[model samples]
Target chain A: MCLSIPAKIISIEGENALVSISGMRMNASLSLLSNAKPGDFVLIHSGFSIEIIDREEAEKTLEIVRHIRPIK
Target chain B: MYPFEQYHSKALCQALVDQIHLMADRPLRFMEVCGGHTMAVRKYGIPSLLPDSIMLLSGPGCPVCVTSSLFIDQAIHLAAYDRMTICTFGDLLRVQGTNGSLEKAKTEGKDIRVVLSGLDALEIARQQPEKKIVLLGIGFETTAPTTAATILTARKEKISNFFVLSAHKLMPPAMEAIISEGIPINGYICPGHVTTITGIAMYKKIVENFGIGCVVSGFEPLDLLQTILMLVRQVKANQPKVEIQYSRAVKPEGNPKAMAIIEEVFETVDEWWRGLGILKASGLKPRDSFQDFDASEVFSLPVYEISEPEACICGDILKGLKKPQDCMLYGKNCTPDNPVGACMVSSEGSCQTHYNYAGIN
Candidate 1:
């Protein structure tokens, strides 16, 4: 049951943050994360924001995959 | 486009598959150590795209699948108490114990609640202060931190009725156990979510000790294919190292705050895995400071000796020794609607995933 989705934080109030996954909004706890803020994307697992997603790193991975030429 | 949808691009996945097909020259057996990875691989038909030389085995990753029957039996026993409410994940509802499942117990009017998160269980405790709430904690490191957080919240809010029957397991020790048991695995597709909390250090240790490559992967088509391609490259170069293909969510050091919560609330001990048996320091339990929240300590429950069904090969399937097809009851008797074993019960489980996506394009 380790399935988690990347959710963007819409707002934060104390240890709880309102995160939007796709179009659905839910409350996620920021107790596990130190620097999560509004508009930042975080991985939500079991009602908690486990980690903040690194957008730069994500784009870099996609960019690297985009450049991989298929072997003939 | 949604930020996570980029990893699901069909074109990127095909490219990685093409690269894997071109690079996989020799026979290599790789095992994915996460149930989420297993589901994604089957759902995306990843094996259909790969060369026959590259074999992928599902590891003992599904927490529900690996949980011993005794744990289920104990939970069932606890459910018999009139003043007790057993809060568990939805997947655990149908998993059969020695006598019956929690679903069966619920039908017989037991106080069983299906909670999505441990915090939901705490909320149940807050709502029903007259009854005791015992959360059936089952998962790897990806989930343990959340349970730890729930316990801390219970203490902070003075929720005395909340308890956790922790069946939480660690991924690295189980990985090490599989290797030490002489499983013929060349590389590993590590659990992406677990690594988000534990980081790559444990995987680095696995690579150093067993000289096998590992790739922490996300649960998507492109992610699995890319991870497989990375592992293939490592095998081709004879260089075993740990890589993070899911670097967007997982970092090298992982989530230190999450780790800190887990360390504060729980301690490792020998745990029983259905297939792997008891592995040392593989299970998590609430520490002495949190003993009041520990279900095992809070209640003196009777130990019930339980055995796996004689016909089910879930244990073998978990060890990567057999496939779901190898089990005679896989389709005939053990459909998801009526699961005969733990593997067929959880959606992330190999048997259930195989049953659902079998022969799919």
Candidate 2:
């Protein structure tokens, strides 16, 4: 249950949200989530949206990737 | 396609290997404390990418693997009662209890249901209102809140038929236990999902106490490799601190609502790990307010003292003292099909991961 994947919320229907990972879509319970909206990336674990991905943190990982240079 | 190939492409992995070769010098051992990380590292052949100087160790990460046999025995005793259905994750079925495994019980006409989530068990309870439904809630922080939320729902709906035998554990205590024993671990690849709930800041205590580098990373291959790079650099610079490589999912503060929900339904209790003896306040039990929803409290269970196979060496494996290969029974008698040790039972277990990726002979 620890294994989680980042999925984008395609639509919100009450407490359940239809999240898409790549192109595959599945409905996850957002009962624990407070105010997650569509287009936000959430960490899906065991059919529950545990955490919404932070944009700045996503950029930080990208920043690290940009800094990495191939060694000689 | 499963996706995320852009981050795990062969070209990117090759470059990461080259970068490690240029950067690394002396030998280092890093223990990945999550089963998910262990599977990812072995599945992607990440070990082959690194120089021989670097080592990766797997800890007691799998909840199914580390759950004390007494817990399983208790579940089996519950299953024996007529008009009772035991719900659990698929990983818990083949686990051997004091007398026999859950699969064996199922074969003997016991109703054991494998569920995807704690809510699924609640659903079963709702459908079969007459039967006593017990969800075997076993996991780390990642799963406890989900079970908690389900129990709260059951209480609100006035459903007394549902109860949870919670076997959830916290990660930091186990980390502290390992470090205190002088395991010689240089750094830790902290669990991403657990950190997502508890936050990266919670690990500061461990880093401060042990003076070892602790970092969180995602499951993607590039993310794991990048964290390894960060860990090695920390060792080289003699800078030991907590960092988050998986900041996208994990923040410094963590998910407050999730943590609050876990606090609502369950409280920390002394938990017995399969290999490691009972760690203080390491496990979660139902709070007194939610006593009616606790399966163990509602129903009496007899605990059994079951020792692991003498030759298994799972205890040493969990403590990071011995690799799966170090055990004589690793492949010869402890195959996943017929697991003598708990470590060989789950897909995330180091032995199972190694056996699946590279043929264990």
Best by lDDT: 1
Clash pairs (backbone) in predicted model 2: none
Fraction of native contacts (fnat) of each candidate = 0.84, 0.60
Model 1, position B79, has a per-residue lDDT of: 90
Q: List RMSD in Å for every model shown.
A: 1.3, 1.6
lDDT of 2 by residue, B1-361 (tens): 2324456666665666777777789899999889899899999888988999999898888888888889889999999887999999998898887678898999999999999888889999999899999999999999888899999999999998999999999998898889888899999999999988888877888888889899898888888888898899899999998988888788788888999999999999999886788999999999999999998899988877866767888888888898898899988888988887778888898788888997785
- In candidate 1, position B159 carries an lDDT of 92
Provide all candidates' interface root-mean-square deviations. Answer: 1.3, 2.5
Q: How close is candidate 2 to the true structure, as a TM-score?
A: 0.96
lDDT of 1 by residue, B41-82 (tens): 999898899999989999999999999889989999899876
Question: Best candidate per TM-score, number?
Answer: 1
Off by over 4 Å in 2: B1-4
Q: DockQ of all candidates, in order?
A: 0.80, 0.59
Tens digits of lDDT, candidate 1, A1-72: 998988889999999999999889999999999999999999899999999999998888899899999666
CAPRI class of candidate 1:
high
Q: On a 0 to 1 DockQ scale, where is model 1? A: 0.80
